[model samples]
Target: MRTEEIVAKALEKIGNDRYLLSNLVFSRVKQLCAGAKPLVDMDLKHNKLSDIAMKEIAEGKISIDRIDEKNL
Candidate 1:
């Protein structure tokens, strides 16, 4: 799916709050950069970590816990 479509679906799963979504994506990207595996399988050579993270969130392969954010 296209990045925009993936992001739209992610918003549906996460909520319409763009700021929270951005933070989630940023956090997931950091984890990806830190050597965490991609939750959604995709060609890493072509997709950016941020895109993969969004896709994972959209597909329900990843989830965010608001309560846990306090410690991060």
Candidate 2:
């Protein structure tokens, strides 16, 4: 629905899933491959995320629930 919502969802699950891997439709958006592994790693290490999924989330290409934070 909104970037805030997407980020909210990511953060909601951050505690339980520091890796931020859950849900289906957009699992690929969260999944990490060789080229994308750094992205996920950096997202977690930097405590942020790329906007590649921004449009998807905004456009409802992906669905999110909530977010949380972890100590890491």
Local accuracy by lDDT, each model: 0.80, 0.40
Backbone Cα, N, C clashes tallied per candidate = 0, 7
Model 1 stretches astray by more than 4 angstroms: 66-71
lDDT of 1 by residue, 1-72 (tens): 777898899999887778878888888888878777786778778888988889888997777883155244
> What lDDT does candidate 2 reach at residue 60?
41
On lDDT, the leading prediction is 1
Query: Candidate 2: lDDT of 40?
Result: 24
Compared with the true structure, the alpha-carbon lDDT of candidate 1 equals: 0.80
Model 2 C-alpha lDDT per residue in residues 1-72, reported as the tens digit of each score: 466776566545434353443343245344422134332212534433355443333344334442112111
TM-score of each: 0.84, 0.28
The C-alpha RMSD in Å for every predicted model, in order, reads: 2.5, 10.4
